[model samples]
Target: MDKATVVRKVILFSALAATVYVSIGTSDEAPVQVKIPTSETIQRPAVSVPGTMQVAEELGAESDGSDPFEPRNWVPAPPPPEPVKEVVAPPPIAPLTIPEGPPALPFQFMGRLKDGTDEVVYLGRGDQPVVARAGEVLESTYKVISITPTQIEFEHLPTKQRQVLSMQSN
Candidate 1:
């Protein structure tokens, strides 16, 4: 009746047509149909049942001894129990916070002591030589976040990458 229904019918007919085309294209011989006769000994003649037959069956088939309807012979069904629903509790909520930093100093500098993020503590890189070894204790201006006898580590706040700057200490 509608355009959409017509389009759907067209698509269905196209698919069937494609299938038939493929089948016909691949066939080599012509198809034929043959009807065979059946061999039955006693052919029971059809008889019209009385209008009251159904009523008689429902009334009482067992009392008459002859059961025109199927004898129930049905076993008793098992008792069914009510379904139980599970009660799920909601999950607990908590605040997100980074763990405290370690107590160890970032470098072995020894000029001034300061706190960082209430976790990291920094020592001043005061008058220390531009070059300071890992075990070497030196004074610093506290301006340098990272410096070493061999190199300095430069870390951008957002990028979070530490770039190594070689020390060209004179």
Candidate 2:
């Protein structure tokens, strides 16, 4: 064998022999015994305070036969709060009406167009013509609910009233 291989084998054998010698030496010796005296025999007084057992016995006698720790001993829930009387709500009052004539918006419906993708409507507010699709809000208060080729529907935001504009024949 090479000089390096021989040296490595010698080192490995020596380490193994040392480990076996340590294990065998330790096994032959007795383990250290520590005598820590625990207070196992020290008796505790049966009752720490006088008359404590008597008071407990008296209390137990006052209780019903049911175990205090048992679920059955819990006080029955107060008869489910007298079924809250269904309060009859008062009848609804008529909605407030605008004394002024028919509510008018500054804008006027100009025309409507229906493409395969969406239905759009044209509204003329003053000089500007606004194109609105379904669900678009116009002039803040008016919301275009739906638009068709001939007619369009708008919902007044505040009053929730629906108004229809139809195509007028020339």
Candidate 3:
């Protein structure tokens, strides 16, 4: 035979021989015999461990239908404390008089302006600014005596006390 025909016949023979070997090797054998014990044949010890028995009793495992894992048997924790009330403090009391010296002036000198021939000075007491010329009375107590570019003079009407405020430069 030629070389190619001889190689094909050898490969076909090898495949057939491998198939037969695997089939025989995998054939079923006799089933194994297993013995199962009956309740009458199986035996348990007459006594259990003392500690295990005590634990089981405490967990209610021996009761007729009680289950230790049930939520109904557990006690709920107390409700959270009531929310605290906010405390409000009272307003402070004002003093009757100054302990020493004259009372402080609330006016702040802003700037000066010239209206006609008379000079006008602006003073801030709180939020509103006051416009004053020479001899203008303010708050029924402070009398404007003179107005200058750098300063303005005032006299307390009741006590005749003179006070001067200089312009604040910015």
Best by TM-score: 3
Can you rank all candidates by TM-score, best first?
3, 2, 1
Per-model TM-score versus the true fold: 0.23, 0.37, 0.39
Clashing pairs in 3: none
Task: Report the C-alpha displacement of residue 11, candidate 3, in angstroms.
Answer: 99
Regions of candidate 3 where Cα sits further than 4 Å from its true position? 1-101
Displacement of residue 27 (Cα, Å) in model 3 is 99
Q: Write the per-residue lDDT of candidate 3 for residues 8-120, one digit (tens) a residue.
A: 99999999999998877676876567889999989865655556546567655785455445567367878999999999998988878745433456689877778689787
Candidate 2 segments whose C-alpha is farther than 4 A from its true place = 1-97, 100-102
In model 1, state the lDDT of residue 117.
26
Once model 1 is optimally superposed onto the true structure by TM-score, how far is the C-alpha of residue 71 displaced, in angstroms? 12
Which residue pairs show collisions in model 2?
Answer: none
How are the candidates ranked when ordered by lDDT, highest leading?
A: 3, 2, 1
Worst 10 contiguous positions by lDDT, candidate 1: 112-121
Show where candidate 1 strays beyond 4 Å.
1-60, 63-81, 99-147, 156-170
